[model samples]
Target: MSAHTNPPAPFAGVNATWIYTLGSIVAVYVLLDLLIITDLLSSFADTRSRGMLALVLVSVAAAATRIRYCWFLRSDSGSGLPHIGWTIALFAPAVISWGIAFVIPEGSFFAAVQLWFSGVLFALVASRRLRWWLILLALVLTLIPILVSGMAGDRVELGERHPATVLITIYSLVLPIMLISSLWFWRVVARLDEARSLAAELAVTQERLRFAADLHDIQGHHLQVIALKAELVERTLATKPEYAAEQAGEIRLIAKEAMEETRSLVSGLRDVALRDELENASEVLTLSGAACTLEISSLPAGTDAQRVLAFVVREATTNILRHSNATEASIALAPARGGFELTVKNNGVGEEPGRDGGSGIAGLRARLADVGGTLTADAGRPGAAGHRSFALTAWVPEGGPQ
Candidate 1:
């Protein structure tokens, strides 16, 4: 995967979810800032309104900073300690808000709550190694408002005693939960980053395995033929020079054929076409004792889409022959909305082939995906006579993917 590749979505693995999540979070925070700051201003009108406003605005800036930073860092490419500049931009508002919160007289409740929330945001954006210190700092900042309130003799009271004690008790319990929850979110993001890396690695590994298998399939038999011809030429070199020369020429031709096959495999253009695939599938199904029917529509030959669909046909046929005890098979190709669809179905699907519907199907799906196509295989619905069948379907866009 490239650096630009996006990490999958918010736990559902969708790619577009981040956009929605970001927008939603921003909207919610904006609403929360308006409500909470308005309430604080009305309740503590005699207090230092300037410091309270600064604290509220700074807290909002802190939350926005963390949101954007954390969102960017959600991708695999975005992991690591953020730059010094980003670190400053992310934490400066939180620190400034704490300073302002400590000085806002008789506003301990709003100020302390704001500090707690902003600290959580800072901890959330912090790297794992740095998060511990940041969480501790947030907790300490949570205490600073009460400490400053006590020293200023402006501590609020819920009953006969100062509410600062109750506030400390509440924050002491709440801050850890917030820290743990933030850490859990970070951990999940880290796992997603790791998953993306592993996925890219696995794709490379599968491609390598595919290349090895194709190389063997293309050249293995030709190599044996060349070997036999070479041995014959050596045996008759002195006794029959002309025969040996002919054998040598045969070996050369065999080698040339192998080279051409290798080239085809390398270029991903194997010797398969839609018409040829239809004929081959019918013959294979017949040999496997299945009655085969084909409903092919006319199409331009040698198109990229035709070649890909032809490969799909070949793979579906091979799967049927190897894995099923079908008595009847049908291959169909026709026009669909803005594209074409191919359906290959066979009766007597004993079991679903593999974890991912067999390697052939998996590989076909990947190839089809490259051309904006898709492959789906299912143990299809029960037929009229209660016979279960397997179906492999592929669809390609009209001109294929860019």
Candidate 2:
């Protein structure tokens, strides 16, 4: 048999989830800034309001770029140098807003705080060495304008001693730390997912190697002895015909024994218990972030049908891992139609073409056929949320294959 290559990473959906969540957080922060900017725009002259609008737009672009970079980081697919233009865009809003505060000094406090939040959001994508520096710079830049405006005898109430100024300052200092901490936690999760994928692949490879070793042990000595006996038979045939015939008989017996042993080895390998398979499937799905439910009862052991059903469960687990973004899964085994029925279901049916018609399911159907069993797979209609479900069912006679 050809060796199995590692399947695609099972964490693509997980990564997409984290990416969407991160983007949502950034979007909320941007929306809050836009609200503040809208208020500021009404109080300012047209030219300054236009500048503020442009600043907000540039900041939005920078936020999008940050999310993109975070995705690239998580996927480990980024190449070439980081875009210089995005870094400039990220800082431009804060710089321009600070410039406005220096000139006009009216309503600079809120405007500076909102733009600083945008700067911090984008700075999260910066390199480790630069990220903190950029954030600190944002804090210093924001505070300077607010303090200068207050000290300049403006009634903006943004002085070093004002309650609002102190609170905003503390928030500006702490918010970046909080955002960075959250991103750091997310990065750790991505790494853990990567490690889990590697562990799973390694386990598969190790099992294959072990099986190969066992096969070699089973056949190696038998083949060697058969070769030696054949050589003896070839030599004795020229001089002692009766002895050669006896040796030939021994060779035939040895070959038969080898065939039986090989068959027994293969059967033993295939005879996985149904209950064990269900437990393993549940554990695997739960580890992959799916909630797995098992509704199974004890079945009699050492039956061909039981073995085949166990194999079906194993294959279904593999399919669910490789082909679906399932958040919930269930495996049910019960009596139906004078036999045992096994059903596996999941909510997140992916859009992989020919999923039900794929080679994996076809091979499964062939196996079930050998045991006088039937297998059916369906991608059920999507729900109101547009999330499709998939179900795989297998049925086998109680007395095993006829």
Top candidate when judged by TM-score against the true structure: 2
Candidate 2 lDDT by residue in tens digits, 1-402? 798887655446556657655765666555554555465555444446655565445445544554444443342222333567655655565566566666656656765675577567656655666767777877777778778877888854335323345544565667776666666677677788779899999999977764654355345534654665677788879899998898789779868966886787676643445686688678767756689999986574437787678767767776777677899999999888878899999998766337555766676687788888899888888776666898999998877776
Alpha-carbon runs more than 4 Å astray in model 2: 1-13, 45-81, 155-171, 269-402
**Model 1 Cα lDDT, one tens digit per residue, 152-177:** 77654421232234544554456546
Off by over 4 Å in 1: 1-32, 43-80, 90-97, 100-103, 127-130, 147-402
Q: Write down the lDDT of every candidate, Cα atoms only.
A: 0.66, 0.67
lDDT of 1 at 381: 69
**TM-score of every prediction relative to native:** 0.44, 0.54
Weakest 10 consecutive residues, lDDT, candidate 1?
A: 156-165
Q: After superposition, how far is residue 233 of candidate 1 from its true place, in Å?
A: 4.6
How well does model 2 score by local distance difference test?
A: 0.67
